[model samples]
Target chain A: MFRGIVFAFLGGACITLQGVANSRISHDIGTWQAATVTQLTGFIMALMIYLFVRDGDLGGFRKVKPLYLAGGAFGSVIIFSEVTAIQTIGVTFTISALLIAQLLVTFLIDRFGWFGTTKSKMGAPQFIGLAMMIGGVLIMKL
Target chain B: MLIGLLLAAFAGMMVALQTIFNNRTDVHMGSWATTTWVLFMGFVASLACSLIFEGSRTFNLQQMQPWYWFSGLIGVGVVICLVLGIKILGPTFSVSVTLTAQLGFALLFDSLGWLGLEKVAFDWKQLAGVVVIVAGIYVFKFGGKKKSAEAVQSASAAN
Candidate 1:
């Protein structure tokens, strides 16, 4: 539990960094260019590390099903779309949209057991919590 | 502003789904391996998009600022931290905490003008929202039935 809390904080910090970086990048470069370039750089870095350590077992790239591959594609699109939106809508709004979207996706995926994972049933509290989060997000922007 | 918020939310939710997928399938490959594959995929996808959308635009790495590079590094760090954090903290809590922290940092940066954001005053409503959010987080974390019930029983016994 202690460790979990630490992880939570650290994760939060990292994400904050991402937000700051994204904001800065958006100001500097075209939203698409910035996002794509950053992702590419990160990808190259990750790939390099893998090459050095994994002894050339790039099989994970090949092992997954086509739909799994689609996850990556979808992720890119979502990221680019959000970044573009941030330029027009403002940061708070963007973040709020993201939070609500996350809650909904998580709820559905959990409840439906999509993508070969076990389903997560949502209680009333969870639903209420999701709504509260969405409301808060909107309120923050407003 | 509202539209931007919605877009950001949509993007975040998409990320969440990806995370769920990662949790399910990532065990087959360790974090290092999984990160590599995802980054590669993202790279490929982004590159393709860039080509299709912005044809003939030379990507002159030399012309880019240091922030761009730092941004990517930060992204890598975030990915690692998020993966590790999700393992320790459940998804909902992890995401909430992360976003809260992001907001906290964002405010500081905004105030300091560190990230090129102009100085903006934090109004009463923003403060109230922050406080309310903190309270909500506390409730979500400690107000669970088991913990609350245990506390109530212990207090009753003492009384």
Candidate 2:
């Protein structure tokens, strides 16, 4: 329960800034450009932090493989686009749409065991809840 | 209009992909390592696309201001927090609460005209939308039926 509270609070903070960051990226560069740059910047920062904190050597990176890297790139494009949408559709609506999109995609992925995700069974509640969430996002559109 | 809608939908799909990948990768690597790989790879991909389409001449670092980099750094913090939250709490609960909180924060930021953007006043449609979204999240959180007999029996005794 305690961990859950901390998670909720941290998640709240992260989501709070997500809109501002997205809006900034949109204005600073073209949607695609901003997304790409942010990813690079973020990646550089993360790598530097790892180097200083972790005792492991650079050899571990060689094992990362190109396929995983490509996967990351594809994911980055999606993230960048989503953030850009927040500016156009407002945060509330964007998030609602995101929830629906995520649920459906997750179902597909899990059902088919795509992208290394676990092959889990989707319960009835999960489907209904996802539908309700999507319906809510649609309502927000109005 | 339809084009824009489709693009947004596509972006939403991307976001989901990122989440799942990040979730899986985070297990093997720490958040920083995972994030670095994601961002660095993304940058390389973008650069390649731009260079191929717009040519190598498109690589102009001078065009970007310092503030642009600062904005990216801010995003780094946001990502770390978000990842931490997701790791600690399940994605469903974490995303639901965060989305609700984000709406409130984004509204406040928009109202203040901070970050040099045009100010948008609160309106009825926006207000109603936010309320409905929040309600929906709560409903989604608690709407599930009974769990498996084993889950129910264990869950009850655990508390």
- Best candidate according to TM-score: 1
Native-referenced Cα lDDT, model 1: 0.57
lDDT for each residue of candidate 1 in A1-142, tens digit (9 for 90 to 100): 5676566666566665566566667566555566677777777777776677773345654666666545555546766766666456544445545655765675576566676655444456655555566556546656
lDDT of 2 by residue, B1-159 (tens): 334345556765765566665555554565566666666767777766656655644455555677666555655665655555555665555555666666566566656656654667766666666666566555644455232211111100000
Per-residue lDDT of B137 in model 1: 45
Docking class of 1: acceptable
Model 2, range A10-129, lDDT digits (tens) per residue?
Answer: 556555564566566556555556656666666677677778777343334555544544556774456555656666655555555655665566557766667665455556655666
After aligning candidate 2 to the native by TM-score, how far in Å is the CA of B130 from where it should be? Answer: 2.8
Q: What is the TM-score of chain A alone in each candidate?
A: 0.79, 0.76
DockQ of each: 0.37, 0.38
Per-candidate chain B TM: 0.71, 0.72
The prediction achieving the highest lDDT against the true structure is 1
Model 1, residue B21: distance off in Å is 3.0
For model 2 chain B, where is the 10-residue window of minimal lDDT?
Answer: B150-159
